[model samples]
Target: MKTYIYKIAALIVIATALHSCEDAIDLEPISDIGADGFYANADQVNLGIIGAYNSLQEKQFDEWVVTELRSDNTQLSFDNSQNANVPYRQLDQFVSNPLNEFTSSYWRASYKTIGLSNHVIEAIDVVEDATLAAQYEGEARFLRGHSLFNLVRLYGGVFIVTETVDASQARNLERKSIEEAYTVIIEDLEFAYNNLPDSYGSDQAGRATKWAAGLELGKALLTLGTSDSKVRAEIVLRDVVSSSGGRLLDNYEDVFDTNNEMNDEIFFAVRYQSGLVGLGAPFANLFSPRASENSVVFGGGDEFNVPTEGMESLYAANDPRAGVNFSTSWVDNVGNTNFERFISKYNSDFGNVDDAPNDWVISRYADAVLLLAETINENSGPTTEAVDLLNLVKNRANQPDAVATDVDTFFEFKLALEEERRKEFAFENHRWFDLVRNNRAVTVMNNHFATDFQYNDPDAPFFNTAPIQQFQTLLPIPQYEIDLNPSVAQNVGY
Candidate 1:
């Protein structure tokens, strides 16, 4: 990673805003007085926006775990005796509680990000340079929309805070309708797509770009699910695919190498540095099997989200990503061989057990292209255009082409696209959302539970499985937040 990436972490302190009352769910206690006088110069505004970017890292791990573990891609890796890790087990089992700490922490982290981005967006008008002000606003709005998009998808409707607010105002705020929240998300992303630059110089890499907004906007619109919105998504995503000047890497493994941090395929990534500066990403350390348990895997981790047998079975024997994404067997440091599966995609030897500098890519060109294929198929059933797009990804992975002849109907094409996405993006925090978006979360999970539930131990308490209720798709509102503000209502069946 470059030095400027670390600068993002260093500038977060300047952007932390302190609110008067600490208990308000919408109010952040960190002071934003810096925003008052901090927008006078372009350099200061740039630093402030970097601070807002750093906020994304605050919830990255929880976001991935919540999305991935809750879906079919993975299962909780803790032993039956490990009571300390029960919250994660509950999440994997679809019985997460309102009091789960991961739920509350992720919710608070998201709000904190929204608060910081609001500070930047609120102060941008003071910037004298018109071009710089527009750019800053675009960046801030993109960040804010990105945060809100994640929130709505995870919890349904949530408090839509666009501007900085005092303690009293925060106390009175309530959750907006899902449509209302998405309306704001679209508006912000539209402004971002229009104003953000198409690309940046080397020193300014990893910053949000016009294509980032376009891709995210397309995803948000697709999530909203209307004929017009899906059409619009196809158009926006097609533009990103054609003009973004990015493509699938020749080798899929190169895309994940720690030395190749921001490759051509990456549209945006959370930047990190691995040394003693304390800014490296923790995925490597946390994803690796515990050092004492499997030293050959390199690095130490609690091994929270191990890949499931179903996930392992998704790929063909010749698929290159299969080898890079996980390990079915490995030799321990002590020369004993083990057959347990573990995620190997983020492995990096650069940092210590606590920190590894592997950058977590949030979006990439292949993902956007695959999404484009989906939207195209959704708009018009089983077109060659969509088949070609899917094949492009398969070709890059050295896998056989998906026979379009077999996909004669819209329903069949949808299933094929879903499986491609599942295999392409497994363990990258996209499985749960993919299942939900396709309206298959309930059916797929219930079916998976019928046969694969209690995969580690067939006699475990939830050994058989319960049907996933429709309302359970949206997580319960954290009990801590509801207690703080009685104005907020909990999601049904909490």
Candidate 2:
């Protein structure tokens, strides 16, 4: 994230051989000058790669509704009765069905990125420079694998479309088992780790590096939770910590400073530029308090992914990241003070309505470091090394560092780790996945319903009690996807 190379490239980047559609996963246009003809030259192939990265910009706006909003870490700030807020309400309450529009849009945007990556993968073969072609494919695979990882986690078994296909073929294709899906994901990341460079030149600042791919691969291996996979994950992630040339920025706020963007702490981020050629982030405008409207963002804020009171309290007294994460109060147009707080991470770069230059971070060094500690704990148990890794993040937040005994046992260490992550990455969209991957989603969310839903939560009083069973942990397959292809069965209990 150090260099900002793309001021012009953020201009609507079309993959030379791309056939993308943002409506559905398998609905890419069947006819186009496919990858081979249009991206026959090396320069065109690079453009196709850049286009895949550009596709990620579209998903940043909606990714959190399914991720953070679904978790207890964030909630809809108010109990409003509007139609557009209904999907968010359903998700926050754990009653969202497959037809939830927010998840549907998220699904479409994810697949658009995946589809674009696939086109770039196929087109890379036309480039004569073999090394460059492999690097390009590695970047494409990292993006595709990253998207597939999200799809598999959100919806159970999703269609594994690695290539362009006609509607007929896509309709007939069956969803892969979670195991089968991960097989493809791990393979792609493995290829990425081998081929991607440890670092890129200034010309390609934010492109996926070997360290980024390794962290993601280590995460996939850890998610598998097999003994062999955990061992591999530890090895992979250890290498990232020791050799990646990335470090946690000392000042917590400096990490997200709008003007001081370049730093080694970022491993990979969905890059955004704000000149309004269609590639800026919308978190500032969309997630700010609606009351702040023209006073804060030029247009009104939607109050999406607003902080929960429980989430706000996670920060310790004088914790460094608290101010950077969110703001507690706002004065609306009529000067009414409200508790409907907004996230401040993306607030610094607000350019206009729906346009902010803040990039959405997907992978960062601290995430990897914490994950490394998790891998070590799972692979072996709580060790000195693991405790050190856990304390690194805490120390950065000005919280007291943990001693060996505090996290001496596996269960204690796990809980401590989760709490630290919750505080460190509250609105960055890590809470739900952390719970699910560690097998606590069902229990934690049910507790949220019983306690928070019944008491102080703002939106809780609006809806009936929504307790989730085991099956509810996995979202119902998007109703639109099932509607498009009758063979695509919905997840059980839909």
Candidate 3:
């Protein structure tokens, strides 16, 4: 079991204490002295902030599946239909309904975080210590930004709740436009960028920092896709790349090694630890190969987020990361060679399927560098600088450098960078957002559906016969949410 530095006990206690209220009004703080008496001092304010961070842990399970499985990079795999997990498969095939469990959980958990952050932000002023108050406010804003960013990216317009609200208020609220929601997300991230510290000690290692906020702010701006926003994103990204003290690990495999987790390369991640009561991830059982002979997770694989063979083929013949990322074959308990490809990026020896210590990475230095390259390429045609930035990530995997001089047009340069990003971050839950951010989601995914079905089907006739409907791009607001709140409306074509 890996030993994580952060004290997860506090997060667990806070999560349990607030579980009932979280399910009630999405999330509301549970206080011994009630909301009026809560946030009376620095300690209480910090506890409130911790309550917000716990939502991230709650959201991580669906977040990974939503971003990666919906894209071409991964699929839910099992030998038989009986073993198939439909909640994920429905999403994978773009036939998901508004009542899909994972989608519903994502919505509820995201708003839960936002609600807790609002509580902290609204109450932090009462603290007597100025420095402590600012810190709490900064952390709350960072989390609020994080929640809204994820929400807005998935569902275009969303309900923007900046202050704590009652059930009646929530039920009566209207959805904000994408532009309006982004405005608040940007403002919160800007506050966090300016107010947060550069780094924290070992005890507080998982908390937000200035560089984390800056990276997120830059990402948020780039998502806008405006020329001015891209230019501004470049400025923020350049500072993060040049001065944040974050760097790519020399060995590509080391990035996922629990021993080397939270390395200089990682800007922010949801921390986890094994050997604790309630602090371990489930990726081991979720991604492991489905084999009855295996010892872990009761000798069967849940088989979620399994990588596609096409994704495996994208890497160069010499790419070292492929070995660490995927298991093309595994030895069974009886020592038979079973050739079944499965995701291995989060693979580690664990006590059970439910208890994995691997931390889920949110952002890293390489993501910033790639986005900087994207912004640079968008602002101007392919430049030597842009190619060099792509090469930095490529070189770490011992891959050959990209030849950008021959790439004469902006579109061609973008395709090159897209290929690099797809290979670099295949199973890391960045592919869907990358395709959407570059405006290639429909075309790329449409073509992918054709090829993927043909590849997965025993007969070629299935290819292109089952196409994803265009309106399936953005997920529908959960039906439960709409039933709970009268003012909310579902996404078009749901």
Candidate 4:
């Protein structure tokens, strides 16, 4: 996973703000005490970088923006009720809603981080050390790119702003075309890739590395090509050749283990300490069930996002990952060992504590490998090499090898691969995107949900029963963005 530096950046900002404001008589203007003035020394520059990293915390703005609203996972049931609190469940063609709290929080949080990244990037150039300046700049770019990628994927075409704007002006910012938005994202990743160090040492162990930028760039290219055939061939070639350094780990599950952040497979990750002073934890409380003894005493036990039956069935029977990813049967709060199923990969013995110290992986080598295989299959067909790569992941999951014989006949293999990804990466936020990319969402979801699935068939079965429309594939532009920016048009049918 790519190590995110924004968390560090956020901490620096808070510290700087506190120190600078300690004396009321120090009459320096706020703009005069800008990042350039503040980052004049190495220690200050380091703090600035740390502040950037701090922005990644859930409270600061990264979690809900990137993960909660994303399509990858859904909330589990609350007290045996089938419906979860996630509002988008209704938007997903399975339920109904007037926008739930999760969706609203996610939108607000994403734009907040975007604003923070813009502020940091605009101020960092004042540092005296050339190398330090480059590092901070690269970190800022990575954060901006990372945030924008989520925005585009979720909203389709989002406003692209490079500098901080007042609330009034921000509201008026127009949405860019998807192509235009991707162009900026590609550029930011490329800049970060060129300027970032190949590796971050002990002090910067979890910071973004060159490989993280490469992975994001490659994925962005893949997204672009998927939407535009004219750019497809070159983008795939570029991605495969440019990202050779990123290789899958020997084991699939190892990538998610708390101790695996330093593994070669990680490209970028959001760092969370067990009890860092300014740093906040997001996953620690969410993963543990209410009854677990280790659960955090205060805000723990919600288990808001639970894996669904469809997600569970995606794994082959007896696959090792099945047990690791979720627990169909576990000892309940009373030590009865109830056989209830819930997401287990994120479970930590820490119980309901808010700071269990598991870092969220944004990108991993396994995804790179699977992407390489899928790209090869899409562009040329299943080859010996592609099959070998595909099986490398499957074999790790302790499942049967893929039986795909030719590239043209690899659709089943692709389906299987998608299913494997759903199981392997459940709750990490990859499912909805996978369905969209493969164009299997409507059909697969209809069958899975037992509703009539049709793209635009008014007479289609379950038209009333299943309220899904094709346009639901792309989420509605947040109503806030529509209200703020007149140039920002809503998605079709919204």
Candidate 5:
């Protein structure tokens, strides 16, 4: 049997003690009590900020969870009608309602990180060093904005807490409108872009940079403008101009290699150090299958995410990215041979049956370039510049250049961009959001899956059976949260 280092009860006791002692301490009176105590100096601020990064390392945000939600993987189940197991590739059918623990964990983890970031931002003023204080605040803002952006996209409207709210008040908080939520996200990212340094020194590699903030802000603005009014469109375009420095890496395939984490294209990423205090499982082990002989035992489990045929078909034959992103076969170090459709993008070995030290990229220049191209095309019909940008991505993928003989209409350009995004970012936890934002999820699902897709069904034990609506685009407020907080209103269908 696999050994667990810490028992669940022991972990719970340690966590409770740490949080409980926060209110009772302050006898020495270093900084303000509670959250403020953690940010008294530069080192302290760095540690606190890193803690926020650690939140992303939770199992729920790991590669398994991300890949499972991608268009590539199918949720497998026993088929009662067929008397055998069948691959249920329909995401909407399984993703709805309060039963999805993956979605629930993501919702809770994002807010927890946000709460930690809120603490850091509030405490920055108490830091005595002016320059250091500004830097710390900028980093905190970036973390806060990034967390909220992910939360908003997944849940639509979420509780927007600027300051440290009482746990009690946190429960009673109301959901902000999508517009209002994006406004705050933009504001925080803008602050980060202005105050953060252009690059971190060698000592601080993997930390947030000004360009990182810009890329994130640009993406946030681009997403916000998609479904909103013309005013939001104008605002996002302006932000895009200021944020995109027009610097994209020449090679896209190298961006995923562990050696390239420090490449200019990588804006911000969560740095993982194996054997460090906060270090945990690496992503490669999570996506590599159990039956594969080439696999390593990190987190003591089989690779959980296997790419589907539909996802594999998106790539053209002989595309370089296909081999680099995943491996259908491989040979081990000792001359042993193996074969499987295993994810190799996050491959890293730490020489033990534990998580390896591999960083997860949050924002990258390649994504920025593609997103800018998409945004420009959406606002105006496909232009030569837009085509050039899109082609740059294709060229890196080792595909023939994309040529648009004629300028397509806005909607047509959008469809083309969606197809490009699906191919370029297949397993990066973006396809679902892309479909939802474009208002094409239902249409796409209906077209692709035919009679297999159903969402929001109360009659079925696994999901809510209610009819899908435009408003159902957002996920329901998690049931446990609503149960705990009486004031919390459920999303339309719950």
Candidate 6:
């Protein structure tokens, strides 16, 4: 069993947390503040941290809709065949729907985690051991900062809730500016990097570490897109590359192999269990061909996050990632003769429905290496050091790479960096944010709508509808949020 699999119910959470979306954040003060005091020891504080991880698992499952499906990486397998998949199709085509359930659930789960982490941060002072107290606080802060970083990137502005407020106050919370959100994210991650441990024991495999926080902090700085921020990011990311004890696996396929769990390459991942414990991952079934029956996995696949044909061409001629990430067709397990393609990263044999033990790897050394290359390029144009960094991942995949003379200008190097990241992180939920980070979402996606979307879903709205506008890059504030919190207005051009 994966460590950190504590019963989330051990944490003091509201009963309605997982299902409620009416409020911006749901919180309730603990009823028993008895003689022992609130969260008086390390174990109690750890429960809240586990609860935050639980919420992260829920939040991250929704990321493919907003990030991968919307990007050129993936799309709906059979857009017209699945009626229940309309919301996914809408996101795939960039439709104007503010009430997408996936979007709302993602928003609610993120704040729900922030609320739980806030409780941990506020209650950690009572722990007697200073080191444990700081580590616990750092973990909580890291979770909170991670949530805020994703929120600000996906939505232009979002409500900021540092302290646990009464559930009644949810209606009154106001969305803060993107600048303010980044400020809190940077501050929290900095604290996490300073206080978190460099590594965890064998029993605790997936707990947040100093290396994870530093990578995240560097990413936030790079996303902020200032010259000085890029320089600062370069310093932090370089340290993660050299001193964080992270190393890439020899084979690209081994990175996601179920048998090689928690290998040296993975820096952080949301661990899952395979028994009927209600804590296992759902991607194996969710990403498989819906009609594959038992051929792809136990039960039937949901056929979500299907890889696009366009994604196949993004890789180089000899690139091996396409074979590892996805496949072209499969025999009909139930004899339906289906050829739908699903992401193969999580193809482990599953028992019950949506109950596979594949850990959702959130950060790895290869990702950090590529981010370092990006920072190096942004700092100095087409530098040899930057090209060398890019070649590290390329060489692993057995693909041809430039000699630094080929990419003479900054723009060429930038394109190379983006393409490398595109293939390396395919179906890992990093595409849309990457485009926005490079300020190429509008141009690249518009071209996709005109060309690729036409090839994939030519009958969809693009035949008569318009491509995404500049303001539409930020997802619309879910209408359900505005319904509950009137003070929180919808994002512009929704």
lDDT of 6 by residue, 434-494 (tens): 9999999989887876676444354554333366788878888888778776778888877
Tell me the lDDT of candidate 2. Answer: 0.79
lDDT of 1 at 80: 40
> What are the TM-scores, per candidate, against the unseen true structure?
0.95, 0.93, 0.94, 0.81, 0.80, 0.93
Per model, how many backbone clashes are there? 7, 1, 0, 44, 9, 0
lDDT on C-alpha atoms for all candidate structures: 0.80, 0.79, 0.79, 0.60, 0.61, 0.80
- Candidate 5's TM-score: 0.80
Give the Å shift of residue 199 in candidate 1: 0.9
Candidate 1 runs further than 4 Å off? 1-3, 15-21, 29-34, 78-82, 291-299, 462-464
lDDT string for model 5 (1-494, tens) is 12222233433332442342122111111223566645666655555666555555662353335234433233232112222211222232434565455656666666666766777777777678887787788887888798788778767788787777665555567878888998899899888888887775665676677778877877777777654533344454345344545345666666766555667667766665565444545566656666544444444335455565465666788777776667676555476776546666667766554456566666666676677777777666688877787777777777776656533667766777788787766566677777876777656654444333322223433432323455555666767776666676777766
How far in Å is the alpha carbon of 198 misplaced in model 5?
1.0
On a 0 to 100 scale, what is the lDDT of residue 465 in model 4? 30
Off by over 4 Å in 2: 1-24, 27-31, 82-84, 331-339, 453-461
Task: Kindly provide the TM-score of model 6 when superposed on the true structure, using C-alpha atoms.
Answer: 0.93
Indicate the worst ten consecutive residues by lDDT in candidate 5: 20-29
lDDT by residue for model 2 (1-494), tens? 34554545523346333455533474462236555666667786677677667777767677888888888877775546545577788888778888888778777878777777787787776778889889999999998899999889988798887886665676577888999999999999999999999897776788899999999999999998889999999999999999999999998888777665546898888877676756677888878887677765667687777776676677876997888888887777787887656787887645577777788888888989999999999978999999999999998888888966779999999989998888877788889999999999988887776766433446545555566888887888887667767878889988
Poorest 10 consecutive residues of model 3 by lDDT? 458-467
The Cα error of candidate 3 at residue 226, in Å, is: 1.3
Give the higher-TM-score candidate: 1 or 5. 1
In terms of TM-score, which candidate is stronger, 1 or 4?
1
Identify the candidate with maximal TM-score. Answer: 1
Error of 2 at 490 (Å): 1.1
Tell me the lDDT of model 4 at 84: 47
Off by over 4 Å in 4: 1-12, 15-45, 59-75, 78-99, 226-247, 276-280, 290-300, 406-410, 451-467, 484-487
